[model samples]
Target chain A: MIETFRRVLRRLGSVETTSVLIVLCAVIALLGIFLPIRTSNWMVLPFALLMANLLAALATNARLKSQSMLFAFHAALVAVIVLVGLDRLHAMHGRVEVAEGSMFDASAVAAEHGLLHDLRLGEVRFLQGPFEITYAPGMKRRETESVIRIPEQNGGWREVRVGDHTPLIFGDYRFYTTHNKGFAPIVTYVSASGDSRTGAIHMPSYPMNENKQGLAWTPPGATKPLKVWLHIPEPVFDEAKAWKFVKPTNTRLVLIDGDERHELSVGEVVSLGSAQLRYDGLRSWMGYTIVGQSMIHWIAAASLMACLALLGHVLSVLIYGSRIPAAGAEHGG
Target chain B: MALEPAPRRRRRSHLIAAALVLVVIVAAGVVLEKMPGSGPTVATAPQQSASSGVTPFGQAFAKGIEAMRLGDAHTAARAFDEARAINPHIPEAHVNLGFAFLAMQRPREAATAFDRALSIDAKQINAYYGLGAALDASGDRKGAIGAMRTFVHLSDKKDPFQRKAMSALWEWEAAENGATPQQGEADAKSKPEAAAAKDAAAGETTASIEQQGGAGTGAKPEAVATKDTAAAEAPAPSEQKGEAGAKAESTAVAMLDTARRNNAPVPPPLPAIADMPDALTPPEGVISIVNVWASWCGPCRAELPSLQAFAAALDPSRYRLVGLNVDRDRDFAREFIRDTAVSFGNFWDGRGVFAKARFQVEAYPQTLFLDSSGAVIARVSGTREWPADAAEATVAEILASGQKKEPK
Candidate 1:
């Protein structure tokens, strides 16, 4: 059994076995790219095998063991692969939309995360403030300047302006502004039973669904839902000229209940059968793409170290050739 | 005994180094675990719940339909749910509920509802379209294409949604083949069935439910969107004559003949103006309705009478109606307008620059609703009966929206 184990280790440490493992990893990676398989879990197998093979090679290969630079290079490569694996295990991607003046609710976010992702989004608290977005002609979105307020050590708030490029980082997570802003109608609802509540209804995205600016909403206290359409009497933006994102002041909520349609302006009230709706005003909402922090820096560092060690080993071999004394050569001499 | 073997010593040192590296990595992991914000927490998805009541199925279904017509998918869903609770066998309720869920962006629930509808009634045509759309949204393109194909096969050729389904199928197939819809459409020309489907070709097909030639039960499924409700209106006298109507005018033809006598390809209807006028820049407090039209466009000529009447009836203080003639040959446009007796302020778009660039118009007879600031409030493609109440109601809605902006 001991002899068999030694033979297996020797085979695993062989260059031919390393080449086969590498080819298998490449094949798996290619399959992942071409096919619709999730590579996150599948990648761990090949990497783990490669790491084991490398360790076996480090232990059994006498010539390799004698070379410190080559050994260090291989060790750095192992570290890089391990770091990348850990990173993949904990990475996450998410998206959230917050209306201006609203608090960022972590629970409202839609995300996909790895198995070991630390869900600490609840610790990240911030409030969305006013944001400005510009558009070029033909409705091509340009820059976005979103203002967000984060809590400070002192009970006050510290304001930060983040945009498409900049991210509002919170520990390991980052919130980046995306080009998905739209109109949000703030409305107050009063049920026939005298219960009242108010909130904003985020409409469909602007310019993209400019004509279809309608949404079906159920009020807080109402039994029946109502359909609300934002009616803009004037041009939203000129396709011929550059423009900025702004809420139209001259817009009304066209509320439809059953067969009845009533138009309401700001502060105006319209009665449905079971409830009454009051148009408070219109506001804007911004969409954000969220990403968890990664181990990319460590991976890059390890890779750089590996490259340097490999370069040093190559230079040593080029300069000294086989004259570089092996471990037994020095002692035997 | 005193001197350890050099190879063994070196191996032990390598082991120590490997152990140290392992210890360091483990330590780093431990530090990271102990770092701030690494606490155990669970992310919760937003939840939505609906309440049901003890209501009669008939009343609930009616309420659902009314709510759907009003665009209230939530209420419609609830009502349908209530109706389904009272009577789970009704396929229409399930179908409508599926559509409501679709409107709410819950494609999974919509698919379930559509599946239920299909389980109840295999021939529920609307359910197939809803199922296809839901499946498509849920990233099941193959299933979506299958469902849409089934819908097209089961539906009448004249069914309005059949054309939409055909368009969707073409898009999906094109996507699957790594080609564009235009390319798919080009390929479709060879297949007779696809050609029949392609004949509709968006913004041109004018078949209505009555023209379905008595296919199925004739139970019209409610439109998912409220836009383009006027697309099914009957054609006008000019539309009945089609392109031949443009040649009906004696004076217009005579002027064209005069241009033909000169051997010039229909010279300018009148003396060539130095420069074409710019697009309509609305005055303060006035809303402008720019009707983009061309003499060659049959639908443009068909809707001219209603537009003329609607323009005449508009309140001059608040609204201004104008014509954007995109006819390349100025003679045809000038004579056509003269023959038609259209008096609205006509601006020439001989080169179609403003029509294409400013309005982004693809089809003719598109009306742009611009505010006093010359910002486009809305763009209605295709034709609508201008004299109808729907048109007036649309304008009234716009007027109501702008009421707050009126100078106090």
Candidate 2:
């Protein structure tokens, strides 16, 4: 037993063995780019074992001028690989499909845990879910009844929805929804001939500014041209008012009656003596989008940097070892 | 001899490195093979049809052509509308859609579609012709003539069909001012009939042109001679008859000569409008409503029904409604309209200007309400409600007061 141990140690400490180990490590680093190490719990143990074997092999090799530097560089690489493997064990990710006319809450679980992260919302169903949820940088979810369900890898799901944008950091993985168009404008049309008719119409919602003009429809050969205006719910008021292109919060359509004038609210109908007009509902909502927070993306980005560092270190060692005379031959006496 | 061990160890290490590199190469190749392919595949699956995959704009274009060929301005208008929903950049779609509107007797819509097509693609040939056709149909003869002159300038004069169509259109313009070839033929036919009527009144004998067999070739010359001789003699009934006969002979020759020179084949008379696809036949216990609208049409935009409300109120089993959008931009149309809770299908009419030429539509927001038998029970040309107790009230009435349709 003692003799076999001695022979094994001697072989491992040889210059030839050190050269072979360097070649093997370089090949493994290259392989990592394509067939990435499996980070799941089941694969973690095998990965650790492989890493331990590499460390042991590196440690037993004879010391040369650059040996300590190479060892330190490789040691850092192993540390990163182990850390990433642990992260994979805890990381969570999946996809979900929400049908038209439905709102999906992605925060139901995170709310219970009192955690929140930025969210993304895309294409709301006009009737069922009027608004798509999204998150801004550093935004957090407030407590609410809104529920969103996100799928988990282990055949479970997480719930989330509006009002949750931060404090929900589970491992390195965070969740987001797609951004989509959300603003829906309500338009009202009043006929000019004092018969107060009103209709409800919808227009695409634009960024909030008080200056945007509302669109109105005119009927063929109507006694009076259609008098049209828009009603925004939350009117942004300003004194200087340089930017009039911004949509107003409060808009009303005023029509002239023979003797009296009448005003129609957005999405309201009025009858002015036979010339019926009404405020039409929104035609469309535009310009909503969903995006992920930069932080989570940054965490995944670190793995790439580690990979590049290992690649550079391996190349330098290979080039230096090939160009210089063998250290073992020079030391021979 | 001393180099033997070093050389053997070096060779062994080199072989191991070479093997490791080969393994890495093979593994990378395998992984690359599994990577996703770039872009969408154009090779359609066997189950998919070319027509089904066509964008909304293409579908509207094809439908407009089909409608024009069949002379059903309304149906053609609806189809062109579907095409415009897929793509608005296609100017031809708008031109053809306008033609459909024109044929439906909606001149205003035809003009708008033509104008829109020209705005998107200035060199659109069909839009120019459709504009002329719409103007001609709408009682704006001078405008029609001007548009036709533009059409003539733009058209390839070398094409036989186009040349004939241009000549016929010009002739129609001329005829509107004075006597036409058809009118000349009628006058010729009338002269003989008048001679017969005069003979009955005067109690005198008149030579029947039909009786002059083989003398047919000499008929014109003899008729002229007889007219001169009678004029020289006395103011008798025969002299009056001879003058009418000579005029009739000249008119007939002119008519025949014009026909020969133009080599113009008379087009079959316009098909009865009712013979066209009136509307989609609704299932039993259902009312089929077709709403014709355009994106730029303000009133049409205002009166757009709350799809959700309509879908909720109307029992799908009893009522079906379709929106026939005449929008020039397919993306804008789809994005704007898709959010509505309308359960029924939508169609695009591609005849931008020609819709008016083909459909004779005078305005937008035209609602054609049809019964289950597909017969148009009533039509609302503007934004107004049908009487509360009429066959069915308009969408505005239903949403405002929760008005329900009484059973027919």
Candidate 3:
């Protein structure tokens, strides 16, 4: 058994055995492209068996004077194959869908924005077909004023579809839509006592202007001149109040402690006493997007690149060895 | 020294081979690592409100469109309502719902639906058309004309539907505006003949009218009214001649004016005949796999090799693979097939008949696997790996089974 093992080890380090292994690896690589790795696992057993046979064939070959580089190359190939197998076995993947006009953060929105929390959501609504459903995250329930009926398309309802770039995040999971808009409403609250405030609010607020006719009322008067401006454009504005409507402006506002005023923009948020306000800018209603990648995939990719580079170097040396010129007839021919 | 050099060369060859193998192994490993897995598993929660489903309003809208096309007005309305319930901001649902109402002949409800759609999306063309139709059905010709005029203003003149709609709007406007005392007297004198002629013309004009509001164009109403009146005065055969004569005279005059203005070629009259081949039926008794593909689909291009191999390996007597090219340009499809050296039968499906009616395929490289009886058995809608052995096995299994017919 010891002799047989030695013979196999010697064969594994032979040129013919290496050539067979090369063919085997090529075939496996080609197969990997076409078939799911899970279903293609059956091919791996045969490949291993073939590898063993090649090693056995190499054991009987005459020992070359130098074998370090060849052995290193073979070892590298084995290492890559083993690592890939492990990666395929352990990899994990999934998808997420995000709605339009919604925001999602896995960490504290406050830490990043220098507000209070890692993530902050304004107002969120779901647009299915004719039905509109508004959701308040704090309440964890639907709001009565949120449901709105929309027009249909082609005698049916219009749908918001998502793709990779367009994602709708509810909580942690994100949904992407094929088509998305880059507009969001900015809600600013002004206290009654003339205290000005600004921040990003989710839903459309009463229109604000110098006259403040369209603006929503400030908390019952304490006198610092207060108003709440909802900056997002409504799909259907009241015809009578049409003149007051303005295109959603990037400018956002928030009143801190009903005293200090801060203007926020996209990717910024303001802090009010006990309540954190974020200016989540407007984005188009895109659907869910699923990202299917794992750490193992990255590791495998890096290893493969290294192997390819090493292979190229080895090939160059073999094709242009110094002995070729010496073996040929002298120029005096 | 020679012996040592020989050994070195042998070692080098071994290294090269081993290195190649290593590269292959590493490449496979890297690809496996980079291979994107199925997207994150959607957290399956307990049954929640319908709104909680991540289904977008767009998909619901598409469903509503499908229901409407099937002539299920009630279902279409329900779908629209569901879509609106999900996203009230989309204007398509209201317009489609109004269309459904119009189909059900509920003019008031239809008008309201159109109003709602317009309120959401002022530029929506269908809403205006539905509004006009509802008004016309309710005998409010003036309101209908106003709506139709808006539709015409928003439509492109070169579009076939737009041209047809313009003609209808013009005729309707003309008939309403051209109520001369003489025409009224004549109509009163021969009400029966006039009514009969109007009935005959209605059939020919309905499609044009429906198309008109959607394609908005401001066509001259006077000429259209004259044509309508003439059609009402004559019998069906005589009406055709009168209409043809009027069209020729008007078209000739328009052409002359156009030529003089720009020194350009005279434009052709209406009903420009298109040079396209009539639809051909696939061979009988063979399962025709119609693959709708564009040259742009990477998956489609990748799968071509496998498909070609399958085609080469298959018994042509048992199956037929037909590629229905849905490209905007026919030459592109031809060139692609030629460059790829694909040996499968190909045809242009420019009319989008198969796409619209049978499969409703929205994505490219969609394959509809048909049974020998010419019924669709299965569909592979996206790019996928086709293992030769597995495919052959599936084909054999399909052949062996007695259940060859697909359920309609």
Choose the strongest candidate by DockQ.
3
Name the 10 consecutive residues with the lowest summed lDDT in model 3 chain B: B212-221
State the lDDT of candidate 3 residue by residue for B1-408, as single tens digits.
Answer: 245676567667776755665666556756784444222322221222121111455445545544543335566578777877877765656665665565565767867877887897788665665577677666777887787678768844542234434544665667698843344554454433322222222222223322222110111222434444545554254343223222212222222222222222212111101222212223565666667776656677778888777766656786667677665544334434643556676776654455645567778888766754446676676866655556656565644555444453
lDDT of each: 0.64, 0.43, 0.45
Candidate 2 residue lDDT tens string, A1-333: 976774565455455554665666566666667775532244334445456554544434433223433444444445456545544433434333222223332431222111243233232211112223333333321222122333445544444333224222223223333322223333333444454432223332333222222333454336543333343334333333322222333334433332222333333343433334544333323221223222222233333334444575467778776754444342231
Binned by DockQ into CAPRI classes (incorrect, acceptable, medium, high), candidate 1 is: incorrect
DockQ of 2: 0.02
Candidate 1 lDDT tens digits, A116-199: 998889998887778898999877899898878776666667777788878777888878999787988878777768888877
Candidate 3's displacement at residue B294, Å, is 14
Model 3 per-residue lDDT tens digits across residues A1-333: 986776556656455556777687778778778867635547676567655644443333442223434344434545555655555454422322222323332221221121122232332333421112222433222321111111243343223323344343443233333221122343333342335554222222222111111122233334333233322212223433323222333333322222222323333333232223434443222222322222354455546555655665477569766643321121111
Candidate 3: TM-score?
0.25
lDDT comparing candidate 3 with the true structure: 0.45
Query: Candidate 1: which stretches are off by over 4 Å?
Result: A39-43, A136-140, A152-155, A221-227, A256-260, A322-333, B1-6, B9-408
**Residue pairs of candidate 1 with colliding backbone atoms:** A235-B375, A235-B376, B269-B330, B269-B331
Q: What share of the true interface contacts does each candidate keep?
A: 0.00, 0.00, 0.08
